[model samples]
Target: MPRLAQPAGSEDAQDPVALLGNLVKASILRYVRSHPGSTIRPICDALALVSTTVQPRLNELEAAGLVTSDPPWAEGTDRRGIVVRYSVNDEAVTDLYLRLGMALGEF
Candidate 1:
C-alpha cells in the first residue's frame, strides 16, 4: 500500500459531480479498512460521527458489497444480538482508492 495521503476537502470536492461520489466512497472504505473488526461505535468514535450520521453511510457501504454484518449470535434465552463489523471488500475498494489517488492527487 502506498502512503495514502490525507484527503483535503478542496481536493475531494474538485470536479464534484464526477469525483465526489467516489471520493466519499473511498473515504468510507478507507475508514472501514483501517478499523477492521470494528463495530459502528468505534467508527463513530474514531471519526467523531453520530450514530445517525454513520448508519446510513454504513448501510450504503454494505449495500455496495464493501461490508458485511456479523451473523447474529445468541445472547440469552429467546434473545440474540447482532454485531456488525466492517471490512473492506479489498479488491473493489483498493482499486477505487488507487484510481481516486491518480485522478484527484493528494490533499
Candidate 2:
C-alpha cells in the first residue's frame, strides 16, 4: 500500500472522500469551480440551498484551503465586494484529485 503523497488543505491526510463525499460539499465545489467568484446568494440560488447550509460549509471549505474567499489575492478578480465571493482553490482541488487517484491505484 502507498501512503498519501501530500496533504490537502488543513487535514493531516489527503482524503478526498472525507472532503468531497458529501453531496452538499460536492455540489458547492462544482458551483464554485464553474462560477468562480460567486457570492453566497448565487450559490444558494443555484443549489437551492439555504444560507445556513451554504455559509458554514463555505467557511469550512475556506478554512480547509479547498476554497478561497479572497478575490483580491487572485488576479483578474473583482476587488469591490460588500459580499464576499467564493472560488475553488484549483491547486488544492488538483492535489485532492491526484490523491484520490493514488488511493484508487490509478496512478
Candidate 3:
C-alpha cells in the first residue's frame, strides 16, 4: 500500500497525503450529505467555487470512495448535462469531522 504523509502533530504516523485526501473527501461528503440530489453547478455555487475546481475535486473524492455520481439526466433546461449527485460514507467522514470539531472546540 502507498503511504500518505502525516499531518502536523499527527502522532499516529498517519500519512499526510491520506489525511489531506480525507479532508477534501470530508468537505465533499459534508456538502453532499447536507444537499443530496444536487448537481455540480449548484454544489459549486454553494461552495463559491468554479466548475473547473469543483469537478476535479468531485472526481478525486469519487476515486477515494467518498462520493458517487448519479446517471446523466436533463433538468429544467433542454440542454443535456450530467446531474452529478453525491452521497457520503457517513461513518468515516462524520467521525473525522466530529473529532476535528472537538479538537478545535467547535463541537
**TM-score between candidate 3 and the true structure:** 0.57
Better of 1 and 2 by lDDT: 2
The per-prediction CA RMSD against the true structure, in angstroms, equals 10.6, 7.5, 7.3
Worst window of 10 by summed lDDT in candidate 1: 71-80
Off by over 4 Å in 3: 1-26, 72-80, 92-107
Q: How many residue pairs clash in model 1?
A: 0
lDDT of 2 by residue, 1-93 (tens): 556444454342346877775889989999999999899899999999998998778876777789998543344445454578889999999
- Per-residue error at 55 for model 3, in Å? 0.8
What lDDT would candidate 2 get against the real structure? 0.80
Alpha-carbon error at 7 in model 3, in Å?
8.9
lDDT (C-alpha) at residue 73 in model 2: 36
Q: Could you tell me how far off, in angstroms, the CA of residue 73 lies in candidate 2 after the best superposition?
A: 12
Q: Model 2 Cα displacement at 106 (Å)?
A: 1.8
Mind giving the per-residue lDDT tens digits that candidate 3 earns over 1-107?
Answer: 53855457654323223544645445656688888777877777777778787776776665555565665322343424544566665665555556555655576
Whole-model lDDT values for every prediction:
0.61, 0.80, 0.60
